[model samples]
Target: MAPRRCPCGTGLTYDGCCGRLHDGTATAGTAEQLMRSRYSAFAVGDPAYLLATWHSSTRPGRLELDPDVRWTGLEVLGTTGGSLLAAEGTVAFRASRLDDGVPGVQAEDSRFVREGGRWVYLDGVPLR
Candidate 1:
């Protein structure tokens, strides 16, 4: 069987992309990479990966994904900093999903920062 494509839309195999991060074999090299991996986590239904990559200050004690919401696609609109050398950064994206069979799109500009030299999601501002 062929390897599944990554949900991050990186055109790479899941194992070569976010899967490595999800499985703890790799760490995000940038904030944007972390954001993409987080989205992949949601698509693949791995809340543990989500919580592990989340910043401690804003991380919830537990995360429960709504079963009715099915992630469909991801579009990265823009990014700032979030480079291998940057300490902080932001990623703007629109994530498409189906909620109870209803189509929806969530747009947000997310913030990220390096903690212990690893990129972690901090927070996000919903875009209208």
Candidate 2:
């Protein structure tokens, strides 16, 4: 398969967007970077990276990907307190997708926590 593109439709390629980070070239030094990379992982079906980046406490054993769903784009609206060594943080964004005969968006405010010197995705609290 060809390399994936970011959900943001940047046309820059996933490697340029987040693959590099997941591949270990560029580390997600900030919460925002980690958040974007996580989104890119989802778009590319890289569940291993997702599981690896998720906090162990909250990490699930599997990520269930719907076969009919296609993630369209990612629009990160904002983030707060994701600085290095912070205990916790939040990322707010809009993730667009097409699934089950419907095209729509999942606007969410996701939470994260720093553990063992890394940031891990916890879950999201949707904001309508």
Candidate 3:
């Protein structure tokens, strides 16, 4: 089968985008990239990857994605700072999901920080 399209909305195959990050062959180089990969993780139902990429500072003891919720798409609204050369950044995005056939959208402005040369999600504030 052809490689699946990335759920991150990058218009690239999974392997060429978030799959490499999910499978340990690559790391996101910027806050936006990291944000995209996180959305992919949720879309793919990999809560482990989500926790693994969370900043220790704000990471919770555990995370669980509702089994009924199926992520469908991601749309990055904007970003600032978090680059290979920057220590922190914020990404504003909206993600669509369907739970029990009920469609919904979640929007947030998420914070990210570079630690040990990798970007980790710190936290997020909901957006309207």
Q: Which candidate wins on TM-score?
A: 1
Count backbone clashes in candidate 2.
0
Model 2: lDDT equals 0.80
Candidates' C-alpha lDDT: 0.96, 0.80, 0.93
* Of candidates 3 and 2, the better by TM-score: 3
TM-score of candidate 3 to 2 decimals: 0.96
Candidate 3 lDDT score at position 116: 81
TM-score of each: 0.98, 0.83, 0.96
Compose the digit string of candidate 1's lDDT tens values, residues 16-122: 99999999999999999999999999999999999998899999999999999999999999999999999999999999999999999999999999998999999
Q: For model 3, give the RMSD to the true fold.
A: 0.9
Assess the local accuracy of residue 57 in candidate 3 as a C-alpha lDDT between 0 and 100.
84
| Candidate 2 stretches greater than 4 Å from native | 1-5, 8-12
Over 16-105, each residue of candidate 3 has an lDDT whose tens digit, in order, gives 999999999999999999999999999888888999999988888999888899998888999989878999999999999998889999
**1 or 3: which has the higher TM-score?**
1
In candidate 2 the C-alpha lDDT for residue 4 amounts to: 70
In each prediction, how many residue pairs overlap at the backbone (N, C-alpha, C within less than 3 A)? 0, 0, 0
